[model samples]
Target chain A: MITIKDLRKTYDGFEALKGVSFSIREGEFYGLLGPNGAGKTTTISIMSSILKPDSGEVLLNGKNIYTHSDESKRIMGVVPQEIALYNELTAYENLTFWGGLYAVTPSELKARIDEVLKLFGLYERRNDKVTAYSGGMKRRINIAAALLHRPRILFMDEPTVGIDPQSRNLIFEVIEKLHNEGMTIVYTTHYMEEAERFCDRIGIIDNGQIIAEGTLDELKKNSHARETVVVNFNNLNDALLQKIHSFGSDFKQVDNMIYYYTNNLQTELSKIISQCNDAGGEIHNIEIRKVNLETVFLDLTGKQLRD
Target chain B: MIKLALKDLRLFVKDKRSMLITFAIPIALITLFALAFGGAGNSGKDAKISLQLSDLDHTEASASAIQIFDSLKNVNVLKVTLEQAQEKIKNGDEACVLIIQKGFSDSLTAGKELPLELQYDEAQEMQVGLLQQSLIPTVAMLPFNIGNAKAVMRNRFDNMVKGSDDSVHTQIHKESDGLFDALAMGVMQGSGTADIGAGFFGGDIKMTKLVAAKKDNTLGLVQAVAGTAVMMLLFSVVGIGVGLLDEKQEGTLKRLLYTPMNPINILLGKMLSANVISIFQLIIMFLFAAIAFGLDIYSHLTGLIITILATAYACSAFGVVLASFAKSRQQVQGLSTLIILVMSAIGGSMMPIFFMPSFMQKMAVLSVNYWSIQGFYDVFWRNLPATGGTFLSRIFVLILIGTLLNSLAVMMFKKNILKLS
Candidate 1:
């Protein structure tokens, strides 16, 4: 369990985090979702006690992490965005070194290294230097290194980025297993689908502030985001686009397809069809989709998840 | 092709490290070499061969010879007692000493062989050669300057003339006395050579050249091994220390800091590793020198071990300081190379300190290589005991230098590398 209270961080004259606070319960999968430069990594860095916030306190299981850093750090592990590993050393050597730093007994460190190596499916290449590993394999080893000491809480910052789909799936499976085994995890990323599928509670942060926080269904209901009606046009032009815009102001365009959001989808769809016919535009297909986290995020911040 | 070449030129100019290495290092080295080779003002006067003179004979003949030897150019004469001279030569302070025996004047007056002695260390063969060449002609002309050789020749000629009643023989003897006087005056006034001819004074003066005995005959080899070992150890430890920067660049240092340990432990660990490597490197270098060059390592084994440990610690600390001051691996490499080379040049690794200007010799104390090489010289060249005052002082200074540098490095490592402040 972790409690971050009124965390404020500044770099030069720019304020990176302004009174940002959040908490994670025991054995809960908490997601900090935001775009790049949206204070997610800064928050995770402060929570992990690597970066000191200007004015704040992070309590790990009711002890100040900054004051009792060694004790707090012993129960926590961080997987940074960068592949923080020594390429000249083998995976086994790197793991052993980290294990030693964590004060793991030598008798137990060996078994832990082998267990994590096999968990990441890198046991066959454990003897080879990390320079000879593939990008995905290196990413796996990066994640595997943090699990050597089996901390109570794990902080993963964008671990699945720039990896193959198979590797991503395997990482998610291991993380999910950890969570199911009552290990608390604080996962930070800009991927909406990962947050939706895996997070028990999601906090949508933007511009150093958490604007929305709840479960998936609770977020959709609280955000008041309407269902989206996707319409494809055979001959979309400027005139037809203007005619469709006149019907509803809440919409996004992608080439010939337009995503229109509204509560009264039937009336808006009929009116768009008649207007397209009159404007000499052909309708290709139309589909009505339920509101998801993407729509909820757009409704809350007026921007895409990646922006 | 021209565009490609221009692009490369642009890149090279943009890189400050490359530009510094290309232009700055050469300029610095040239300036150091010039200073060492007597390019600056009065450097020729400064670079003189030191000679020690011990006059056991208090006679006029020995004084005259010493005065002539002292008046030679490019030689500085120091009058010392025989005991002092022998001690200096034994401790490698003085290369050679010229000793005039007790009956030098008596032997020259009686027309017997001259008693002169040269006690020198064979290790400094070049200096001994200079001493011999300078003293040879001075010794050859000593008879004319002292004992009134012209008068002696005149009296002999007169006696011969009186014995032989022939007028032709008397006149010839008289003319020969006048010629001898003219030659003796010319040699005494130091105006020109007396035309004494080669091999004429070969037996007149008995110059005994004695070499001081030592356990090892190869002092030059010892100097080379010790100087090169210290200088190269500095370089090797610096390379090892720069691994800290490499770790910072690769992000592993941050990962290490994330563990449940004091951040200073990381720096201490790196320093320890560098020290270990430096010790091993020095041992290997000395072992090779002992096997190949016949260096006497067994005689002063304790002193050698102490010097090596202290030197390794100091050099390793120097490496850490360089790494702490630099922000990147490239910066560390460029800065360390320039600094180490300059230190080596001034600290008597590339050349002897006596060859450099007086100011540069004074500045050599600022270098870690200076202390390290001096410590090794104490063990191998001087053959001083490990517990001797001078040798122990050197070891103490090395340890003190290491402690100071380590403190500075720790402060900088926390503030700059770990961003603790």
Candidate 2:
């Protein structure tokens, strides 16, 4: 188990983290979800042992990490947002070098590299320079480089940002595999669906504090059981959108589709239908589904997941 | 530690800029210098004299004087009837004019001495007094040698020219090495070589053929080239440091910091790779210099290697220091330009240190260039034993400084990384 007690981080008199505390248990896929500048990066950085906390005790298995940093750092693998592989080197070469830094012998590095490359489907492109790789390819290499030493704990920050759907799926698949294989992962991102689907427990942080932290099902059950409905309407312009918005405050139109969130789904549906009929708009198929993690997040934070 | 160092080496090789600066630039500069300056062959150096011979006495005695002047190497013997010589003397072209004033062979046989005038262009002549003093013995020793050789004539030629202490009337033909020969002699002998005919222009003394050049010219040539290499090689350190700055800007350095590796080890790996790159650059330069300039770098290679190693360490340390100080690649580029330009200029990279001002020399001592250049001079010009040792010690001191600077840089870098995170 990893525990952070009263963690504080400041930069030149501006508080980034103000006495926040959290703990991640063993064999748990924990998500640290926050917007930009919410101290997500700082929190993770401190946890990864790259940056020291101002006033905190990071205890790993009852041992204070600050007092025994060398041992603590050795157990964690960090997959940074930025692709950190050396561009001038081949992916395999970068892996070889990073592994060596971790005290892995050449023969060991070679064998492990082969395994990881095959796992990521990067074995065919192993000899290509990182600079010559696609954005997705580089991202895979970055994650693979981190996994070379097989750390007991894995920390990934925005690991799937800006990649294609195929790449995104591949990354999520790998994360799933790692979690099932008993690697305790501390993942941070702004993506709610990814957190909803993947994280065993979620920590929704805002303004340097974790406002909500629990399993997805538990958080949803604890909150009002509301279903977010997708009404994909057609050609409903601005004047019509304003008239329709009067039906519910939690409603936004994107292209032809209107997404609305409400706890009183039966009443909210009647209001939407009446507004559509009065506006002389044809109502499309109303797909009814259970409230997802995004709706749960919207109810809690009052913001969209994509935003 | 060794494994980590090797890992750093792998990372270093992954960087193209590091390889380019340390290997490419030094060898290029060395080759450029070898071509621009003397490689193995000094270009067409021979005897040259600026003289004005005015024959006032056009009789047999003066004619013989003119004949000796004509026989000298590259000597422009002007046969002006004493009138034209006067105009040239004021023009500052001629250093000295040999004047045969109304002297005949009859006066020498009758034992009556006549004055021989040597008019000099005082403005053009830097060492007129020395030249005048030298002319005395040369003019008198001429006919004495002829007289001594003709023993059948049974004449004592002991009393050659009778004149005052400062001024002597000529009684013999002359022999003298002009200014170019003197300068060449100064340069050659000043370098401390054991050779005879290097300055010999026969009067009565024969050319001493006993001495031979001990230090091979090829090895000396290579040593000179090494000086140029040392000057340009310092810039390579800037390249390595800049690589660090680039990593920082790109956020890779921050990522690396997240690794379990020691921050100290990280700095160490970089510095070690930088040193290796510098050494490799110098080696390539020497190898090419040997092939192109016929410079025998193989002879004093151990000495050269030490100097190279020391220089590399200094540069690596300097680069790390620069990287820590720099916040961006732009900052690194701007700062590297300032550092490399200043060091190269003060350290005598563009020219020889001897040509640099004494104050500049004082400043240069603070640079790796000064020690490197001095070591090169010892190897190339003097070819003296322990020149390499002297260079090696200075280089070791530089390496020590480099190590200290690198440590400081690592500390600074750690702080910077934390801030960035």
Candidate 3:
């Protein structure tokens, strides 16, 4: 379990984190979803004890992580966005060095290194230098190194940012297995599907603030984001656009397509068609989009999930 | 082609490190070389040769000789006892010692050959030659100062007359000796000989050249090994220390910080690796010197080992300091190259420190190369014992410098590498 309270960090005159706070229960799969430069890495860096917050505290099980850094760090592992590996050294050697830094015994470290390497399906290339590894393999070893010490909590910051789909799926499966085995994980990503599929509880952070936090369904329900009825029209004019705008206040128009948010999609869809026919605008297509995290994110932040 | 050239020029101008290495390093190095070689408007006084003198005779003649040497504008005379002079020569502090033998004044008064002993180290063949030449004018003027110029000339003319076999040569020598006798008589009234040829002291002072004992290696080999080894070791350790920057760039340094270990441990690890590499580099260099150049490494094994260890430690600390001051690997390369080369030039790595100007010699003590090379000189060329005071003092200063630099490096690592600021 971890608790971040009013964490504030500043670089020069720019505030990176402003009164940001969050909490993750033990064995909870918590996902921090945010776009680039949304302070996701900064928050993870503070929690992992790599960066200090100007004003605030990160508590690992009720103990201030900054004050008890060594103790807190011993129970936490961080997989940074960058591939933090030594290109000149083999995967086994990198793991051994990291494990040694954690004060793991030689015999136990050796066993753990082999087990982690195999777990990542990189046992065959353990002796090869990381320079010789593919991008996906390097990413796998990066995660494998963090798991060598087997900390209680794992912080993965966009671990699968750029990799093949196969490697991404494999990473997802391995992370799922780790969660099932009761390891608390704090995952951060801009990918909506990953957060939707893997997170038990999700927090959407933007501009150094967490705007939304809850389960998927709870987020949709709390956000009050209605299902979207999307319709494309030909020969649309300003008159037709004004008429469509009169239907509801929650609407977005781009080019000739309009997205109408309505709780009564069935009734709104028929009325929109009739209005379009009366306005002499030929309808091209019509579809209904169910309310999901993407719509919930857009509804809460007024922007796309990646924006 | 012009566009490509302009593009390259733009890139080069943007890279400050490359610009510094290309322009600044060369200018600094040239200035250092000019200063060392006395080419930058030097008055030649700063290039004085150190001459150690021991007045065993203690006569007025010997005193006059000492005074004349002291008054020379380009020679520094240090009056020491015979034993002290010998010790200085043995410790490589003085290249040669001039001993005024007993009865030197009597011999000069009687116009017999003057008794003088010049004990010198043969290892410094070049300096010994220069010292020998510098001593000639002082020795030639000794007879004039002691009022024995007429007697010395008379003795020399008599030998010439006696050795001549032809009647014509004897007549010519007698007539020339009469002219010199009149001039000596006129000039001798005031105890002054204003002009004398350098050859006048050739046999007048029965000078004995005694080579100092226990020097077997050539000076060139000694200097080359010690100088190249120290300079290269500095470069190598700096190269090794630059790995820290590489780690920082590659994100491994951040990963290491994420661990439970103290951040200082990473710096210490880097220092340890650099020290290890420097030690191996010096060992291989010296071993190669011993094998190829027949250096007497075995006889000075203990002293060599102590010197190498201290030198390696200091150089490693220097490398860490360079790395700490630099923000990237390219910066380290440019900065270290400039500093190390300048240090080497002024510190006797490229040439003997004595060959530099006096001011440069004083500043040489600030460089790691000076202490390291002097330590090696003690072990190889000076033939000093491992426990001798001079050798041990060098080792002490080296270790002290290493400790200070390492402390500074640790603070810099905290500020620069860890961003604790």
Top-DockQ candidate index: 3
Report per-candidate DockQ: 0.57, 0.47, 0.60
lDDT of 2 by residue, A1-307 (tens): 9998888988898788887788999999999887677788889888877778888878899998767887887788889888887899998899998777686778888999999999888999999999999898888888998899889999998898888888888888999999999999999877877887889998877667777778998888876537767677765777778777665557656567776667788887777667777876677767665776776776666666556
True contacts kept of each: 0.74, 0.66, 0.82
Backbone clashes under 3 angstroms, per model? 0, 0, 0
**Candidates, ranked, TM-score:** 3, 1, 2
Q: What interface RMSD does candidate 2 have?
A: 1.3
- Pairs clashing within candidate 2: none
Better of 2 and 3 by lDDT: 3
Quick one: RMSD of model 1?
5.4
lDDT of each: 0.81, 0.68, 0.84
Cα deviation of B193, candidate 3, in Å: 12
* Top lDDT hit: 3
Candidate 3, B1-421: lDDT as tens digits: 9999999999999999899999999999888888888899587777788888899888887888788888887788889998998877776667788788898889889867778777876656677677667777667767766646656776776676676667756666577578667766766675444444345545333343344356678788888899889998889899988988888888888898999989999999999999998889999999999899898889889999999999999999999888987899989988998999988888888998877777898999999999998888778776778898988999999999999999999988999854632
Q: What is the interface RMSD of each candidate, in Å?
A: 2.2, 1.3, 2.0
Show where candidate 2 strays beyond 4 Å: A103-108, A223-261, A272-290, B1-224, B387-393
**Candidate 2: lDDT of A290?**
74
Q: Candidate 3 at residue B148, lDDT?
A: 68
Q: Where in model 1 is the C-alpha error above 4 Å?
A: A224-248, A251-261, A264-291, A295-307, B1-16, B52-71, B78-212, B215-217
The CAPRI quality class of candidate 1 comes to medium
